[model samples]
Target: MFRDTSHLVVEELSRTLERIDPAQVQAFVDALLAADKVFVVGVGRVLLALQAMTKRFAHLGIAITYVGAITEPAITPKDLLVVGSGSGSSLFPLAIARKAKAIGAKVVHIGSNPQSDMKDVADFMVRIPVRTKLYLDDEIDSRQPMTSLFEQSLLIFGDIVAKMIIDERQLDLKGLWQHHANLE
Candidate 1:
């Protein structure tokens, strides 16, 4: 049963990822690479996924931070803000995206809802098109409970973007270890 469930989850994630537009992903990568710094914002499980992305990006030598971290520096026009909210309507993330836009920072929203209020604030969006709380018409249905599929896909999407950056920059895999946290 466990194996069957795992397979089902993987299949669902595969479908969700397959639906993502490659062009949008390329744009996302372009923004991240162009930014002097990257700031991520999300809440709950989505935030957990974003945190993982932040760590992986840092390993690739990108200046990245979670939005509310105590050490988080000021965001400037040269920075990019990445917001992850499956519904794209989460109060905190939406507000932060708006603030980032006001600061002349570039905002990229990764969420399932293209029609969300975030559309107005974000410079662009990388849609996951997965089952969000909004239950939008186009969202891919999931066997998993709640927004599990969206969160899981979001995590993988970050890794995908990281890998793209690695390839595009022709980075040496061994050299990335130098950026990994050594204090642990």
Candidate 2:
């Protein structure tokens, strides 16, 4: 079972890389650069990815907010909401995406499913091809167990986006490093 699970994970990961569109990523990076503010949110393991983005992005020229211990609020025309949801159909994420749109903010969704509820709301959607929770049996923490590809991918994808943002913005290492915390 362990070996099968390992193979499944690798296969899904390879498919995910293959399916990712560089153009879509560029557009997402462009949007982030243009926005006055950026907000990233996710649930469960996906949130770990968002937290990483929040840290790195805060160093950039733009303002980056995240949903962690508290659900941070960001709703404005110049605001961009970035959501990482492997399911694409989760209520909280979709609802927040809707609210962001209601306030004229642009929405970006990173998920395994392209046809998810949030897809319709997203101005930019980066699809990562991975199995949905339905493929796995119930486990204590998984949303569903045996299917954590999205969670894992979110971590990787967020870093990928961050690099894209850096390049698109033409930010040098020193510029970003300046945003680093002196106290820490």
Candidate 3:
């Protein structure tokens, strides 16, 4: 039973991976690289993934802020907001995205729904092909519990994007370490 569970999970993930659009990922990377400031927002485990990306962005010398952090200043036109929403219909993220747009900040949405509400306001979006709540009845149902596949994929995607940034900027371990907080 355990082995079967493992195989099922792997199969689901592999399918999800094959469905990702590299062009969309590259566009996301391009926006992040061009932005003066980047803010990330997500809910639940998705938020955790965004936070992880935020840490790596800081280490990579990119100006980044977590959406609700006290240290996060006003998001302006020069900034960018990267949102990770599995449902894409979450009220909070939608409201924030709207506000960001009103302030002239560009939005990049990463989610499982290409038709998600947030996608409407997004200047750029990447739709991760996964079994999210938005499409639970789809043929490719998740073997794991609700939204786990999407959340896990989001985390992996964050790592992948970080590596891409590191490579694109020619960043090395030594340079990354320099940005690590030494005061702690």
**Alpha carbon lDDT of each predicted model:** 0.96, 0.75, 0.86
RMSD of each: 0.6, 4.8, 1.8
* Candidate maximizing TM-score: 1
Best-performing candidate as measured by lDDT = 1
Per-residue lDDT of 71 in model 1: 100
Better of 1 and 3 by TM-score: 1
In order of listing, the candidates' clash counts read 0, 0, 0
Q: Candidate 2 lDDT (Cα, whole model)?
A: 0.75
| Per-residue lDDT over 71-170 for candidate 1, one digit per residue giving the tens place of the 0 to 100 score | 9999999999999998999999999999999999999999999999999999999999999888989999999999999999999999999999999999
Please give the distance, in angstroms, between residue 152's alpha carbon in candidate 2 and its true position after superposition.
2.1
The collision pairs in model 3 are none
lDDT of 3 by residue, 1-184 (tens): 9999989988887888778889999999999999999999988889998898888889888899988998998888999999889888988888899999999999999987777788679997887877777664542578689889888888788888889998898888676899888999
Pick out the ten consecutive residues of candidate 1 with the lowest summed lDDT.
Answer: 130-139
Rank by TM-score (best first)? 1, 3, 2
Better of 2 and 3 by TM-score: 3
TM-score of each: 0.99, 0.80, 0.92
Question: How large an RMSD does model 3 have?
Answer: 1.8
On the 0 to 100 scale, the lDDT of residue 77 in model 1 is 100
